[model samples]
Target: MVKSRSETRAHILETAARLLDDEGAAALTIRAVAQAAGLQAPALYRFFEDKDALLDAVAEHVFTTYVTGKAAARDGDPVADLRAGWDAHIGFGVANAALFGLLVTPGRTSPVAEAGLVVLRARVHRIAEAGRLRVPERLAAELVHAAGTGAVLTLLARRPEDRDPGLAEAMFEAVLARILTDAPTPTDTSPDLSKLTVAERALLAEWLDRD
Candidate 1:
């Protein structure tokens, strides 16, 4: 059966991603991808010009998924939110080390990667607005970005069994020490509304914010 353009493109990306995972990025040649995806080599050019272009698309496709889900989930506490983002970033990087390596290559640029940064910056900005962030918002964001990326790369470089289990969290705490103010951030003193439905809790928060 013939597939829609998008469906066909998605199939190619999935097949390429599987190849990348199984055999590394070096195995993602257009011919290899075309064969694995069950399409003629020439048919791939309609979706991607060459191996590099295809790799770029695959990185965006994969990172876009990680960034989307990361952005959707949140911790009410700004500090915890930042930590959660750090954890998620590290997890994604280590899990998809091959694609993550492509992502952080010098001079590489990606909208999905930028979106992840946007989410991190927004989380930092929240702390700054609350007077709990010691550093400038941009600097704080950069610090977190650099440190998180570095932590992931470092862990990826190590043998899985040899990796320090606490390394990522330690890096996060170090960045936090530099960025967060001495004054403790406020706790969620708001009454527990666990009994309320999700929609009801959202409505209540919306009402509270309006006051």
Candidate 2:
């Protein structure tokens, strides 16, 4: 049976992604992908404008799978959700070092990278809505992205046995300390004494009584 055009395109992307994962970015040429997908190089160009476009599609396809799993893992706690996202990002980067490097390489804007940023921003927005974010949502997201990416790259640079196991968690804690409030907004009417000064406590009690 003849495959539909969309199916053919998806097959090409899948083949390319497998090749990328198995052989790294250096092996992702139009000739190589076309050969793997059982298509002529010129025929492959019908779906992708060039080799770079094909690589972008492959990256997007792989990244979508990663992000879908991360989204499914989200629970109600915004802070926990953000932490899970960080762990997911680092895990993906470490496991797919070549793909991650390709996605983050200068001068190339992969949809995969953008999708990851969107997830990060959404997670940060949740914290902002909960009043747990001390920094502006955009800035907070940027900070987290910077730190997470740096941690992943730093870890990837070292030999597996030599890499610091706690590096990612430590970097995350440092970034979290900068972005999150000391405490989330109190749901109950009672004041949190530890977070308030004696004078502030009196003011809060008076305000609570007036409510």
Candidate 3:
């Protein structure tokens, strides 16, 4: 049966991702991917501009799938949600080192990555609203992002047997220690607003207890 354009593109991406996982990026070639997908090399250009473009798409495919799966797993408190995001990012980078490399290539901005930063920003914003954040929201988000990326890349550099399982969590804790505060904000201790309706009071309590 003939495939639609989107279906063909998804098939090509899935095939390329399999090859990337089996062999490192250095060994991946357009011809190989096309052959694996049972398509002529020229046909692949219908969906991708070139090998580099194909790799970028594959990176997006895998990383977006990983993030979507994580999002559906479960919800949590603010701090737990932040840690979950950190762990998911590190896990994806390490598990898909070659694709991760493409996603975070210097001088190349990925929309998928920017979306991830948006999630991080939201998570940090939640903590800030809860009065658990000690630093600025932007700074807190960047710290978590930088730390997660560095930890994953550093671990990927090592032989799997030589990698420390605790390193990623330790880096997360270090970032958290620098950013989180236990003290409540001034408004938390302010005089109660008896004039507030029940619904407003409940919403305010939910926001304050987010951490």
Candidate 4:
């Protein structure tokens, strides 16, 4: 049976992704993908405008799969959710170095990366609503995104054996400390105000001034 247009497109993307994963982006040329997919080079142009377009689609496909899996496995605690997301992001980058590099190349605005950022923003917003976020939600999200991406890139730059096992976790803790409050915002009916020290009171005043 002949494949429909959508089926053919999906097949092409899947083939290209397999080639990319197995051989790296250097081997993901239009001619190479065409040969792998058992189609004429010109036929690939029917689904993708060019090599860059095909690579973008492959990145989107792979990243969408990763994001979908994480979404399905989401935990209930917002903070824990963010931590899990961070770990998953680093793990994906480490496991798929070439694809991760393609998705996060400097100056490239990838749809896949944007989708991940959207999830991060939602998680940060939840933290803010819970009064645990120290910074503005958008700023908190950006900080986390930047730190996470940088951590992955830094680790990927080193030999696998030389990479610090604690690097990603340490970076995450540093970012978290900057963005999350030690406790929920104080309330009128809350525990004794005398429990807070002068330094703690000053920190609370500073937090209130952030708005």
User: Against the hidden true structure, what lDDT does model 3 obtain?
Assistant: 0.86
Q: What root-mean-square deviation over C-alphas does model 3 reach?
A: 8.6
Q: Could you tell me which residue pairs clash in candidate 3?
A: none
Candidate 1 lDDT tens digits, 75-97? 68888888877878898999898
RMSD of 2: 7.1
Angstrom error of the Cα, residue 71, model 1: value is 7.3
TM-score of each: 0.80, 0.80, 0.80, 0.80
Q: How many angstroms is residue 107 displaced in model 3 relative to the true structure, after the best TM-score fit?
A: 1.0
Report the lDDT of model 3 for residue 144.
Answer: 92
lDDT of 2 at 10: 93
Q: Rate the local accuracy (lDDT) of all candidates.
A: 0.87, 0.89, 0.86, 0.89
Report residue 76 deviation for candidate 1 (angstroms): 1.9
Clashes of 2: 0
Model 4, which residues run further than 4 Å from truth?
68-72, 187-211
lDDT of 3 by residue, 106-154 (tens): 9888777778899889988988888888889999998898899899989
What is candidate 4's lDDT per residue for 17-94, written digit by digit as tens? 899889998999999999999999999999889888898899888877776776646777789989988998998898
